[model samples]
Target: MASSSYFEDSSNELTCAICLQLFEEPVTLCCGHSFCSSCLENYWESREESTACLCPNCREVFPQKPKLQKNVILARLVEQMKLREGEGSHSVGGQAEGKDGEGDVTVNRMVNVGGHESHCEVCNEEAAMRCVPYETVCCERHMKPPKHKGHNLVEPEMKVEDPGCTEHGNSIHFYCKDDESLVSLLCKAEHQDHEVVPVEVAVAEFKGILAAKYPPLVESIKQVGSQIQQVHQEVRDTQVSGREKEERLEGERREMYRAVDEKVNHMKRWLSERQSVKLSHLEHQRANLQQEMDSLCEEESTLKASLKELEAVSFLEGYKDLLCRLESRSHFSTTEPAPPRLLDFPVEEQNVDSLIQINDNLLKEIQNGRTPSLDPNSAHRRIKISRDLRMATRTETDNPYPDHPDRFDRYPQVLSSESFSSGRHYWEVDVRSRGRWLIGICLNSMGRKGRGKECMLGGNPESWCLQKCENKYYTVHNNRGTLLSVPGDPERFGFLLDCEEGELTCLEDSRVLHVFRGNFMDPVKPAIGVYGDDGDSVRFCHLFMISFIPFCS
Candidate 1:
């Protein structure tokens, strides 16, 4: 406590956690928390658990009684505190004893209340009040001395008196307003040319300055708070919109599955009904055959009964009847039952042309879309960009453009200033002048630097590309390459990106070469990469419609 302010500033660090007072003999535990040695010993003894002594602060257990070692640094600070406390009390008590009785009371009252080393220096008793002018503390009975009579006094809690100047060792009664510093009698001589004011007047002036700025500062805080609230509302709306879209898509998908399931159930019912009808027809045919056999058997029985009636006359008479019946029956014709008809299985052929036309329609819808602009900041140093920033060309050397962090340092690459977060977009690049080049849509996360950078288009998972090399062309994604067997090398190629469907299609000379279905990881921009110099450049055609010259307005 070189000053009471010093102890006040570091009070938390000096105080023991258990005793709640300044440390007497500071010691450190193995777990790194320091506490008073006697307090720590009592804390452990209260538990009586020696196998694991949990730290009071961190609650971390140590295997055994950590040899409590004296914290040399903290011990020194405690000793210093003791010395400084005595010095502070001596200095303040001496100053107060030389002053009025009321001042003496103030000093002693504060000394006891603030944990100073001693009480009032004159009477060695508790102080009740302060002497404002003489800056001292004294008991009420001691305020009636000849030197203390008629002196102004206030409670010690007010602490209105200022500590004397350290340089001149004189009581501070004035404030130099120009320098904004406190000064005693001898120190005021140096500030004679400066504007000096009473200490109370200077405090009032400073208070007015602070008071003037409060309203504006509060208003600024309110303005910032309002803007933050607006941003929060907007972000909430976006989150709600995205969630709604996902829910709607799920509902629609379930509905489609339900429709397909219902169709399959209907077909099963129809098949069951058709099978029953065929079975019923076979049953009727079987019954008709049985009835014909029964009739034949009945006729034979009647003829046999007539044969048993053996009278010659009767036999002769029946003979003609039998013969006539036989002749008539022999001339009669009988029809056989027709076989049951076969039921045909209902099978429908898929339309190959219609199935193949899905990508065609998607291409048409995606082609008429978002406009793109070349980002100069993304262009490589060796690549020269047009004045309007719509075109990029390879130059002999680096251009005089200012460097940017987003610029491509390793590859001859550039990205469009505009990016697509949602919806469909299409662009065709004209690389007729260059022999080798690459064109693709890349994620904004595509790396700007490093070997095999994702921004190298076809080289990494962050992007996909349809690259051309000499007379051949290939599709690449996630560092894997696929060669395309094209009819011819098409310098003019088109790229269609469907963000919602997560599809990327490449069109070469009015024919689609490939379709990549990997979903994008983030908002994406159209990217261009080429290897050409001086006499060669890659041009972007202005088009917004499928199978048509791109028209940019």
Candidate 2:
């Protein structure tokens, strides 16, 4: 209260008579009365071309346009008074009545301020307080004017502007439910048909509803969190159980390997012992047969000796000796036990050996394989077919062959003259260089003239190929390639086509590379392509039918 009184007393001292507000850049005249520097300057400038300056407040004239030395002490006092007035406004209040005098309410409401002080819109001086209803700041003197009458003089620090109605320029007191907005008193009158309530009543009802629902929302959040924790625990439990199962599986796998090894060893030992016994029995039989043969030879020699003697006395003597000897031999043979019967192994064992022999024959057949010659009519221009038509090589220059409908136009590829519609055919190719190459088969009706996918080997449904490009191996069919895990790069490749079985297999150095299975409804010709200009060449080695004899030695 005392602070307010003190500011009121000092307000007159701080005010500039010309501006009727706090001094801004106050300057003193020779008369010792001060006024705003701009006001004094303007007063002098408005004079009739005078070489003198007059103090607007004191009405005193100067000999010349007095150098307006700023009144530093008066400026300081004005600033101090403005700050005090701002502080006093915060603690003051006024009672005002709403329409129909429903009740008296304090007009002043405290609010926060911005960092810098606001200037009065009327006097252009440091503002003492903000008029909330007017949406402007005013000096202490302007606060008393009828223009700002009944308005709340809040602290100059107040940063938020009152939510006033834009069109009516009135304080919003009621909320229009239809518009869902706070409206001024005049706006409420305009919305008289709309459902409206005081802002305070709306706030109270909303708070009650929010307070009731907030607890359930919080409870639902807790329940969800608990379920999430339970899910995480279950996941951890499953991981532990899986680990345990894997460990047990590993242990069982080891045990199975051990048991297999032991069983194999036992079988090996049993077979070895059985083989030895059979061999021993066969050896004994061989010895007995030899003895029998020797005995026969001796008997024939004795008979010849007897015939040579032929004399009465000699014949009789030899005959008795021969008869005695023969009788002795016969007696010895009869006394000896009979040889054991020769027996073969079980049929299962025989089948195992037979399978091995069949595989061996198949390998031998592959070694003596046959090959097809490259067809000149189907060869690309960039591919030079050998004179014998057995090899196709990529060249920088095109071949001098006449254009044919069956020839390839874009890629350096060639098809074999011979095409197979049925029966299994196996062929080999020599791709001995470190160059890009393809070895596969294609339908005889496949496209041969375009530079598109239909003309490219392995790019159409009519073709399937195993290709080596950039030192990697792939089996491509219908434009899709599958990478192959080859043991090593092989110079020679073998392709076996079983039309009856609908299977085509590719092998390198006797190792199976890949196999493709599909319907061979039409005849397919052997295809070979060398990519690049001069680094690649492929030779058609030979083709032969693979004779598969099952379970035969």
Candidate 3:
């Protein structure tokens, strides 16, 4: 049976024999002493390994046959103590009193055996178990000691084997949230200016914040993408709509153009029809008027022939009566009948007197007609008739009608020699003074009286009038008294007369002359002045005036 000492020594059982404390890597020495493995190994190596077993408590030497054993019973008891102590319960160390026949003797023997057997608190029986030797074994009553002598052993809030600060040899307890700085409790005292929090609390706060904001950020990005898609769709719709409208407007414009083209063609057709009708009407009127003119000409010729015949018959009747009277007088006288004396002489004398009388009457009639027709006052009547005829015929022909009807059949007095000769010619003249002067040359019917009266200036019927025969000439007198003339028509003999000075001189048709006013003979420059029956008055003068002087002069 175990002695009561065994139960009483349970309080000190946790302490190793060599270390004098709870076992850390516990082992049994060869001398049956329980100690920490490191401490027993150190003590054994310190000896010389002599054949001896030394007792650490008693200092007794024994035989050299020492053995080492793992303290399995002690290790099992330590594991049970740690389990009970982890639940925040205190462990007891005293053994239970013997119940049945077994007393303290059994307990003491069990403790001394030092093998793989543990005493159960309830059963009081030896139990087979296996244990690791390094664990500390404590008596159930003394597991969580109330007052540790040297160490303040408290329940570990965190595991002791986890990594910690090597420099401080302490647990890392504080975290720097800004820099994720892992700091020990000791470092917090030095780095007090930094914001430090417990590591567990900071981790929890950061996770909560991230969880709260994540949903809204994702939703905002999705909404922005949706709006962009909507804008793209709207732009496509507007472009399609604009294209449709453009096509519609183009169709309408084409229709409008077609309508306008049809209207223009219609107007052109109407205009062409109207022009054709007007042309036909004009042709009909022209044909009718030409027929009427032809009939009038024929009637006038017939009337003249009838009047000549009537006059001849009257003359014959009168001559017959006179002849009978002469016969009767001769018969009554009886004495003159003897000689019929040269009857042919009286008849001839009578015939000559009658012809003279008829000539005188005809001349008187012609003179009366000439006075009125040649006078300038009758110009208005002639001009009216010419203007009417020209206005009627201008659209139908290229030839211009006469302006004055009375001038149509008359010849011009002042005529160009080129017109009379109907050929090309030229003349030149020189001026005598150093100032502006008017020089003109006129061709008439060998006299000055009819110089402009019968002249036809322009060939067109309406323009051939006496008033149109007027020509103005200007010359600068440079005191070079040589007057040069060139003939416009060379075949006809002609003369130049200075009307104001009343001087006339003959010129060979082909000759050119230059002289002062008084020096007709032996001219300084030879020239010829030509005249003709056509109506131009200054034909020769105009052709030659510029050859003798500068245009400005």
Candidate 4:
């Protein structure tokens, strides 16, 4: 009670000229008259002149707009009145008849002025109190109406005053619900199209709205976070598995290297043995030639000795005999001995010789091991499913696969048997020999029968897809199409669905082409399409939707 009654402003200083009530956002004019920011603007608009602007109180003429500063000191007091009213203070005015008259409302509400002092406006003496209703600062001498006294004076609530709205010189009383903005009388007039309400009412209404949705929003955030954690775990597992694979691959490589080295050594040894055999045969031939040369030399010597001893006739006879003997002896053909056939090097034919490097492709982003296949039951009658279910082709005549609700009737399409509700899933389609095809994911909730919007791929919100039409490629959803300017039709296309992130990505030839993000409210199944010129088939290289965690190798 003591603190509440410290001082009070009973003067009409708090009153606004336009509203004839408490000054809301009070502002002082250059002529020294004060008014509510809103009230002043209202007053000035009524006083606009063709030649010059005039003040309503002083009749002071000016030419342009004025400036305004907010009255922080008075704003605090208004807040205190609110606090006091909330505390259920005794009411001076009955039944909340006034804005701040709800409880313990006194004609003079005490305000802490932070020890600031002011001189009386009338006598220029140290003021004992301020008269809020009358808008005056007064000393004790001017407490009563005498030659220098005033009746409206009251105890000081605050030592200083607060400024009002700059343009209208009024308080911001109304809130524009349409724009969620605060407004004064002047502002409210300009915003006649807006749904304006009192600030208090708007506050309660907006708070209620936010409070209603808070729980669901928080829950959604938590759910998304949990999904992210799962993805993180998958990533960690992939790293560990990759490292293990790396170790295994290294071991394989070493073994292969050793085997190659052994092959090279064996080949070298075989080559050496072949060369030795060839040389041995050549050496025997060489020995026979040498022995024949020695015999010929001895025969020649005998013939020469006989020619010296006998005459021409005897020499001729001896020569003939020598020739006959040479002829009769084992004769050597005038040809070189043929070497044995040489062995050919077997490098390419060797085992563990050819190298193939398995590197990361864009499809590898999705770490999944689940290999899905076309659910034969869901295939169209004209769609021919391979025995392995990995390949599907369109034929002129229907194979008459057993009818199922999930089967597509008119379109040559098939969906994977397994549907993914959450987690990451990746699949690759070999479209190298295919000219026209559509690849994407569709909500399982989508209709399976009829050739209407319900069952149309990339024709409704229920589906997300990338398609090929004629020579052009496109991304489509809900009958809308975005043209894809690509170099050529991709050989192998990859699709990645991150249910947690609510994204569907398209990879063309192991390169990311596009990504779609939004609310994936239902489990999505892989949708394969064959249309346009369909000669080739679609092969599912890897329909990996194995589980929450999947890896290709």
Candidate 5:
């Protein structure tokens, strides 16, 4: 039998006596014994009974079946023991059960007589008792437990060794591809050239590239500036060309305007000349008409005088017939021969015959007027008498011998002659108490004389003359000391010749002349004249004529 102390010690083991380990499934037996429940049930099952009871250590038995009773105190004691063992393992080199013994050895030991014993089979010696409370253990060669199979383990070496390049079969000492500098590793060797770099050298090379390219860019910009200037010059040239064309066109326009102005002025001058010529022609026609009108007026005056004389002759004849009738009536009635009947008288018949004879002789004289053979002596006498009568009539009509007005000391007079016979004649006439007049003459009656009629005449018969006078006795002789016929009644030739301070005289004919005073080119006094016929030896026997005298200032 085991002693009470032995039983108490066994109880304190805190392990299952049936399994000889800690109580995983604790149970109570019928004999008031405690054991692992699984161990007790297994023993009951092997016996093939509904109920069983037994003492594990004492072998006591019970007739009734056993009920399970939790062993609270024993479970508390196991939990406490696990805690103490975990603490002890952590402090003592992390061992849960203990350290292993080296070498294969066996040991045997008897705890007591008739007691449970343990022995090592290898060394055959008493085994040291152990309780493996935890699940695993590991050694330094495998740093992880066998349960954690995936972890890789490395052994600690004394020094870190450089890895060898796979391509070179030597320690890697070349540049790293990532940083471009020396590195060592088999894994990093493939990317060495790309990663390894020298920081200072790379920075310097980049700056040099930028500097070398600068001048070319500046030169390119300068070339572009030159091109822009050339474009501006081209534009200026075009502008200048446009201005020159405009100036040329303006000059042409001005020249065209001047040409038009000159043409217009020439036309104006031509028109003015044409108008002047027309005016001159009109004036000439007017002057010729005026001269014809004056001639007609003189003829009208002569016709009127002839009609008045005829009327007077008719009245005188009527008076004579009336006187004869009265005388016959008073002496008649006693047959005293009827007092010589006037109706039968020869006086009336004789008068009629005489009138007829006069008419016939006038007609005959007019027809044979130029014949030289019929009664030459009487013709000569008749011519002399007619000349004398004409002289007297002219002198009377002109009033040459009239009573002088109270204003005149000696009356001034002008005499013009148509004819004077051949001789040199000189005479002096008193014009005023203070002045004397002289008359000189040269006679050339016939053309046979040394003085030809042509020589004596100075100009056209409408133009020539001589003078002898002061203001009065101013005379012009057309036939002075020459045999020149008198012109017709309405036409005469002569001039009143006078001496002025300065004058010009132009003789136009034997009896016609013009006198001008002052400059010959610009005459201040202008006069023309005509002459009447009278015999030689007659003093102042010319007919007086009046003409217009221009007033001089």
Candidate 6:
């Protein structure tokens, strides 16, 4: 007889340390200790912030969190131990009454062991084993016969579940391929004309399908996993690049401010110097005028005193002195001081042009190839704006949008949020090839409420567009349509609206498709039009990739 301690030790081996229960989906850690996958994962999740991942049993630390590997041998052993325990319990419960009148009962475990309602089919006794070939249950007495000796036998509890139809209560033998369901012979009549086959054949067919599809599915998962990692790395790199660029731009802005301040200070100093020099010159001129006036006053007083003298000698001397002095004074010249000219800063014209050029360059760098978002307020009733505000589609049903003056009511059209009044601006649009559509720039004051030529794009003077009607492309402006002969159906096209040049050019694959030359009077915004709900949609490509001259000029 096996000792109780032996069974207890076997049970302990199959038990998990964390749950104190039999191991379910047992996995082995790096320290060679086994645990239930869920229990270990839960324990690790509770201490997720901890730097070191330590094994529960051995307290061994791993450099990184280790992946759990399933222990197949340990799992099989656990199943065997559970089956043995179940058989032992059944044996203990099976007790037969003794032959004596004392009403005593004795248990014969190996012979009469049974569980639930399982019983021998032939002897009508408690069944202990199942015959695999005959698919019947039998007791130990029947199992020992010569006819059953060569038959494959297993514990009664290990018998396969009945494959019977619940509705008809008949054994299932056929499978309906169309419905992918099991059916009995009687149930087969209900699934007439369906591809019915034997259950065994259906199982093999499904197994074959799984074998064909499994490898590709696994490969796809691996590719997606690799893409996820690549995306993660790209995100990190982009974040770092953005931060660096922002810092550089901030420093440049500060430097520009500093240069402006220094120029202002220098101009102020130059004005102060000019004012001081002008004042000093005016003061010197006033001092000379004052001295001359004082001298003339003294001479006049002497001449009057001479005239009052009666003596001939005094008169003659005074006359001669007066005449000489008057002659000398006549020879000296006194002119009126010239008027002071207004002080002006000597700003060079060429320097002003240079500063303007610098400003233009900076603006080009900032606004060149800028991606504009669609203005939801300007979307038509049938247009649906995406959450990103970059895509707009025409739908069958009207959107429940609130009343706004900017909303397009007459046509399925939408405008961009940004309006360009001047400078060369560029943007790209991706066109779907199914239905009619138009992409262009339009005046902000264009009509929006009526289904007239004024409200339609390229039908009035307020809009210029590249229209796609079926496979043909046309440039329309000012109620005029010019068919453009393009090589192929280009799905992606760009619009270059150079307000300064008074031109709007459409480009396909870097080749100019058409150009509309007209003076734009007002600020123009990017516009898109969807004719109907034929899956015809246009998306604004949010890309800032631009080269030098075309976008800047």
Q: Going through the candidates in order, what is the number of backbone clashes in each?
A: 15, 5, 40, 35, 44, 0
Q: In model 5, how large is the Cα lDDT of residue 92?
A: 18
Rank by TM-score (best first): 6, 2, 1, 4, 3, 5
Q: Tell me the TM-score of each prediction against the true structure.
A: 0.35, 0.36, 0.23, 0.33, 0.19, 0.37
TM-score-better candidate, 2 vs 6: 6
Off by over 4 Å in 6: 1-369, 547-553
Over 4 Å off, model 2: 1-270, 273-369, 542-553
Candidate 3: stretches off by over 4 Å: 1-208, 300-553
Winning candidate number (TM-score): 6
- Write down the lDDT that model 1 would get: 0.68
CA RMSD per model (angstroms): 24.3, 24.7, 45.3, 21.8, 61.9, 21.6
Candidate 5 residue lDDT tens string, 1-553: 3222222222335655444457765665654456777876665554434465545444455666567777886776666556555554322111123222543221122222122233222232443332122111122332332221112222221122435555656544334434544433443445634643222223333445676788898898899988889989989989997787677557645654554465456545755665666667666766766776675566556445545655777656665654565465456443212122223423433364455464355334334322111111111111121233221111212322323221111212122232222211111111112222222221222121123333222221222333322222333334442222323321222223222233333222222334433222221111111122222211221221111111110
**Arranged by lDDT, best first:** 6, 2, 1, 4, 3, 5
Query: Judged by lDDT relative to the true structure, which candidate is superior, 1 or 4?
Result: 1
Select the stronger candidate by lDDT from 5 and 6. 6
Model 1, span 454-501: residue lDDT tens: 658888888888877876778988888899987755667888777888
RMSD of candidate 1 to the truth, in angstroms, is: 24.3
Prediction 2 TM-score vs. true: 0.36
Pairs that collide in candidate 6 are none
Q: Candidate 3 residues 200-305, lDDT tens each?
A: 4455556658978989989999999899999999999999978876775576556545644665565567656666766676677677667766865765565455
